[model samples]
Target: MEKNNLYPVFLKTAQLEILIVGGGFVAEEKLHFLTKSSPDAQITLVAPLIREGTAEKAKAFQVHLVRASYHAGYLQGKHLVIACTDKPQVNEKIYQDCRLRNILVNVADNPPLCDFYMGGIVTKGHVKIAISTNGKSPTTAKRLRQFFEEILPEDISWMVENLNRFRKTLKGDFESKVHKMNEVTQHLITNKN
Candidate 1:
């Protein structure tokens, strides 16, 4: 049997059910990213106890918090699961359960057990850049994220919105008049300066 390698996947599980199996800082950080990216997602957090600030934030954000120990049954019907507990055994169990259930799972600090890896992401409207080191070095990913943050134009959001509008307007003709559309977009972007 071929072993599955860890890689980054662009998931469109927005507004879907996501289960988080931890309550510490790591779990909170994952939740923060998910909420920021997909605010409408129904998030269910399963943990015996959550850290102080996390509980308040979960309450404020309306995330469902289930106070319970790690169990394989919790993996059922979840679109995705994140194991952020410090306990290696717990993380491994969650990963195994997710694998059995065909659900995507990310185990904090354990790349080997993860089905998908989270990359450093920078988003401006519909434009997004994701940086990953393939779990070799997170520091490299962070540095790349910093570089993108500095280099990405602040007007990216406006550009993205304009491009979206242009695409909608062009519609089915976009395939035949690609160059003309690009030229028009470039003209618009340049004129915005």
Candidate 2:
């Protein structure tokens, strides 16, 4: 049986600089999801012709638009890169450039060339869930994300906040605190059936 070996992590995009090569629909899609997940992410888009919708969306976020062709120089000072240009050669070049600079790169729709996959993400206040299909089926991941969004309680964050407040008031060793916390939250997983 095949299993996914990819590790999942959450990044603080606000602290990292991101570069996207191209301004087509794929680029726009990437930009939309990135901003939706991390509103404070600093991003730069370089393309000779940017779509009007993409440009308009940039106005609402901290996104810089460089109306020019992509070059290796654009990779400078960038922590992450996304290549989604209409030209396969240009996108491949972007990927190669990113590799040389030790920057993480994702080549849109090309799983083999991508260093990372942007999975479906569901965010509810402080609670966030990321779903991945190991770069195999993104549509399946999207459906799972929608399912989770519907099943999760809207007040889940409030419960988290209250637990945190209660945790701070407890004075004990780390192990004891963990045990007590587990006991308190055990009911959350109780099987009623």
lDDT of 2 at 82: 95
With a 3 Å backbone cut-off (N, CA, C), the pairs that clash in candidate 2 are: none
Which 10 successive residues of model 1 have the least lDDT summed?
1-10
In the order shown, the candidates' Cα RMSDs to the true structure are: 4.3, 0.9
lDDT score, candidate 2: 0.94
Which has the greatest TM-score?
2
lDDT of 1 by residue, 1-193 (tens): 5443545556676546788989999888888877776676788898998998778767767898999998888776788888998899889988888888899888988988877777778776677777777777888887898888888888889877876777676645656568767777676558653
Candidate 1 ranges with C-alpha deviation above 4 Å:
1-9, 171-174, 182-193
Q: What alpha-carbon RMSD in Å does predicted model 1 have with respect to the real structure?
A: 4.3
State which candidate has the highest lDDT. 2
